[model samples]
Target: MIYQKQECNGALYQMCLYSMGTMPGMSPRQRAGRRRTTEKAKQEINRRQRKWRLMQLINANFVSGRDLFVCLTYAPEASRARALEKFHAKMKKAYAKIGLTYKYIAVTEEHDMDGEPVRLHHHLILSGAHGVQLAEVVRDCWASGLADVRTLREGADFFEDTAIYLLKEDCHKGKGARRYSTSRNLTPPAEPVRLRLGEEEEAEVPPGVKIIEHVQNANEFGRYEVMVGRIYNQAAFSAWWAAQRRKAAPDPWERLRRRRQRKV
Candidate 1:
């Protein structure tokens, strides 16, 4: 789990991530190497999911057209100036092939990634009437000799309004390919609460929070929180809180670092 630094109330909070693994069918050596790769990918996926959830919480009506949020990282051996230029060129060619006219963002940084030379790639924001296909975009990159592309739909309103959830490092610093990193202010004044999840009619009280028995359903979201105070469903709250825990946990490497620090 890689944790990004986010700012909250003038304090830094760590943002967790889950990465996706490599595709199936490979030799033993390839399998071993890819297992580690898959773990990293899984961590990234988890991170993005959390970010998406945070965005949904803050901005409910946000729509992310067809723009692609492309994030990539490369092996350290390819970090040289010439290799970097080639990689950049490859990315441009791939985008052109895919007919991406929206936005392209990239970032190449030297970081200690699993003891390997890691070059943080870029983040792309693309827009087109036909919309882009995620799988096809990745295929094109591999075909064009660029690193495998991992992109997602990053809503403008989602990323901007939920700025509080973003890593402080990603806010003003680190740039490769970016067109519009901010979104217009459109967050609603209040958040809608899901009083009743599905067919469960019985109200549940979240641990550490109170539930007003009379609030029945979402139709009275704001009414209850105000009249009867904040209501929390025990099950829903527990699940969400558990998810938060997984996100907040440190990666294996970070754990080792902590252990070393304690020993010293």
Candidate 2:
């Protein structure tokens, strides 16, 4: 009887340690390692969310033929922020003079030239009806150093190429400021339609859209390829979110017990 009681005490002690994440099989170091892994996972989630938001914003406003890509440089005497502000003001005035409206997305970057101080520049995607004259207008309006403008090439994937270029290694680094900005007038992308599928039913592609590729995995979300790019499984995501909310819901009995304890 004493031996059995001791065994029961040992089991209870081990259960307590397990609940505190300090069981014999899991050392403090292992718990700390798990924490590091969780932090990495959180960072990855934040990174992916940022990328998705940027892609969505770009996809909404980008137009192949109507938009112009521009690079602007300024004199060394001017600050980066001041140069950008002045350039924007000048461009707005110039467009107003021409009786046209414009929208733009811009990315700023700084480069340290060989044996020279760091220089600031901008890459801009401007939307307007202006053609080749856009470059001339930018050059004239800039009045600082130089402005190079070109139209997006025909048959090119505007979102893919532009997003990749804008979010390149140098631009994506944590630089204490936003890497890119867009005009407030720019529109957002439409939310993708979610369709639930049965075990036997296959996902159908619309008439005009073409399938590029499909991806499925246990770790990451499954997505179907159609038209422009991969579309994530929104139905699955919605279901998952609903389940999480249900799990996180407050227990009525627990709440009542808490109230009773408070009254005592």
Candidate 3:
């Protein structure tokens, strides 16, 4: 919520509409009973779950202009562990020097076990600092190698693409490694709203907000739809909502009772 308030154009809401096993008359329990699991199917499910959670995190905490998508690399080290250790030490010092506090989530890809082990790098979603050049600070702290810093693009697809790219780090060919790590101070993403929709129905948002992405899917067994987007003008929507809620609703029954009393 704080992030959304700060962002004038970032996504204000993330909404989803999903239904399963209600096609005609089948219950969800019945659909589950009919479903089968395979290794590939299981892997695919895991991948989507991982990506979905990561996307939620992004959508909740990140907004345009105040967040960064960074790729951090390092000089050759003995192992990924050693390189990360050294990087953290440097970052700690840098933070102290800048008198800054921040939160971040980082994904470390696979290590080149057969090669020189220099390819170990991290992709980070980082928050900005007040009155300081965050990217330059990160670059200076990363002294060992290269730091590619970029601003967040304004759209749901950019967020989706980022989540998908980071999810790739988890698929290390069955090596069973850790996925990603986050700073302890970071806040949680928005809770997803569960709902059912009619055919071709879209996620509803107030006026002045833009729908960055809307997708729908259905099958014989289930249906899934999601709408991801941003708000450009919060003030106008607030005013409209207030006006609508305050409008009085005259009761027809009360009006009829008053008329009958007058007649009597």
Candidate 4:
């Protein structure tokens, strides 16, 4: 009879996560005690928060094959901000010319794909449409440096690792530099739906929903479960549903029609 809350990010292969026995969040007292948190601890917290927020935007809006992860690298620059500003002007025009409306999370970087803060660059996750020429367009727009475009990878991590890798320059930031920037268009995950569910009920799967991942954990507080699933398109779902309904409640008219055929 115990009920728990379930959360789903509206991705193609959905991300469903929930935990039981955990308090909603840290208490006020816990927050006040954090005054002693070291600078290193604060940076780690910032990095994790940055990654989590980016992942939400990614899972909700971007898909693996349809979107891209792009890297824009530049020669040594006196002003990193100015270099990025100039690049954005051309990049936006290029995307518009190709009939694309893009959403991006831009992470400013200082690493040389290897060590601490040698080069200046930006990493982006861009929305692609209509089989657009992603790499060519970006390469054309960014003359100062390289534009490497890659398809977003798909796996059990669900782009969590991707976010972390793209934000890898966190440890190399100078003083108060930003961790990342996101375009306004990316979607946030849907609000959670709470259900009172039990073992017998959990065994049932909906007609057209495919469960991709499910995990269950237990403790003195109770059993916690997470389920990730994909909702098939309407046509496929409706066809499956109609077949199930026909089997559950057969049409008597079919029998009569068969009898008439036999008489003929």
Candidate 5:
């Protein structure tokens, strides 16, 4: 029985390493190589997910016809967080005087140069019909530096090209700080619709939708993509995501056991 228990433990250890893309017989160098590769893959996935989430938020909230894009910058010596807070306060007061209620999504970023200090700035998408007035108010309100505001062009791909441009600077900043924020009134992304395809059945493509590009075996699950822009089945996707989370969740007792082992 003792010998059987030892064998089982060894088998479990080997299985765990195998699942992690390593094996029992790997040399130290091979193990290290695999570890680096795994870490790189994880980082790439995380980066993609962050970009996707940012795009979703922008698509859900921003209206091309109603909202204006504004870039707000601060002086080289200004504290970014404090300047942003003050800017928001001033904007609220200014909008109130004009009798306009507004919704906005703002992203803060710092441009890192070779020798100079990082230059902090903000990109905002503000919802209102008065583009010129809004621009004038923002320019006057932001005393620290320049404010550049413009109307979002009709039929322009704000969710794709514009969002990518605005977020590219700060997306790589990691999880230490929020890359973007929005007014409480902004609408959240709708839940995605979940659809499970059989091994042979192709994923549904709505009529008249152009396929921008296709990716085969994009990830571990052999995912594919058809760029229908912001028109995908959100409800289906959300349900599928929730199901995956439940499937991947660890047993509570197993988590407790691991915690106790770590304590020991």
Candidate 6:
């Protein structure tokens, strides 16, 4: 009886340590899951801020007539228009639920080699929802049971997987994870974001719009390069505008008037 009692106490102690994340046998996954809620909240808040800034930069620079960019990938054999229409329906619901507005980028090609040539994908740029990773938004859709989890790319690390969704070099690129690549020696385009919406502001999507969609992932076709380049060009244009704004100082007459007033 004493031996059993001692074993019970030992087990209880180990369990307490486990709950506190101090146990030696805990796996990394377990430890990560056990992180303090406050810490996780802080990290989430900061991540939102970073993502929001990206959105703002993109919007201020690249998006001129339209505020959002949406990219879609249509299967080689599929009807591109129909695929876009279906995707548009999905996107409409998504935006209504989240309450945001974005512009769509039509896909110019497919990105696979199988008879699943009927499959479709999309990329989008929009002006709404500051400070959330596009992947999180996509995952939320899956979690809501609106979409199937299988549709999402597998083995994607939810935390460090932004580069993949953003189409940038994977942190482990050229490492053992080389098998994760979809093609050979081709680095994906980097999808940077810029957010312009403020926390207190709600997105204003014009009425009579038939659909709204979020580009949760990067373009897999040849257009990623084109879109990023467009954004850079927009950034350059914005920089020029800002420079002109700065250079156009107070009217010379106004300055002279102010000087006289100061002297008087």
Roughly what TM-score does model 3 have, to 2 decimal places?
0.58
What stretches of model 2 exceed 4 Å from their correct place?
1-42, 76-81, 111-118, 130-132, 154-158, 169-172, 191-264
Cα RMSD (Å) between model 5 and the true structure?
11.3
The list of candidate 3 runs beyond 4 A from truth reads 1-10, 21-56, 59-68, 77-79, 111-118, 134-140, 143-145, 149-158, 170-178, 195-209, 232-264
Q: In candidate 2, what are the lDDT values of residues 33-79, reduced to their tens digit?
A: 54554454444434433554565665566666777888888776645
The best candidate by TM-score is 5
Residues 56-170 of candidate 4: C-alpha lDDT, one tens digit per residue: 6788778888888888887554445566666667777777877777677778776755765566667888777646667787677677777888887765455877877876776
The positional error of residue 225 in candidate 4, measured at the CA in angstroms, is 13
Candidate 4 structure, TM-score to reference: 0.54
Candidate 5 stretches greater than 4 Å from native: 1-49, 76-81, 112-118, 154-158, 196-201, 218-227, 230-264
Measured with C-alpha atoms, the lDDT of residue 155 in candidate 3 is: 57
**Model 5 per-residue lDDT tens digits across residues 170-222:** 53565776777878876665433333334344443333233342332333322
Kindly report which residue stretches of model 1 are placed more than 4 angstroms away from their true locations once superposed: 1-65, 82-85, 94-102, 109-121, 128-131, 138-151, 154-157, 161-167, 170-264
lDDT of 3 at 69: 83
lDDT scores of the candidates, listed in order: 0.37, 0.52, 0.59, 0.60, 0.55, 0.32
lDDT by residue (tens digit), candidate 3, 122-221: 8888876545577787787676678899886645453777787777645464546667888776667643323334545544565766777666555544
lDDT of 1 by residue, 52-162 (tens): 344443333323554444444445454444544454456556667757432332333433423344444443333323345554544444332344444344444335432
By summed lDDT, the worst window of 10 consecutive residues in model 6 runs over 1-10
Q: State the lDDT at 150 in candidate 6.
A: 17
As a TM-score, model 6 comes out at 0.23
Which is superior by TM-score, 1 or 5? 5
Error of 2 at 144 (Å): 1.7
lDDT (0-100) at residue 113 of candidate 6?
Answer: 31
Would you give me the overall lDDT of model 4? 0.60
Give each model a TM-score: 0.29, 0.56, 0.58, 0.54, 0.60, 0.23
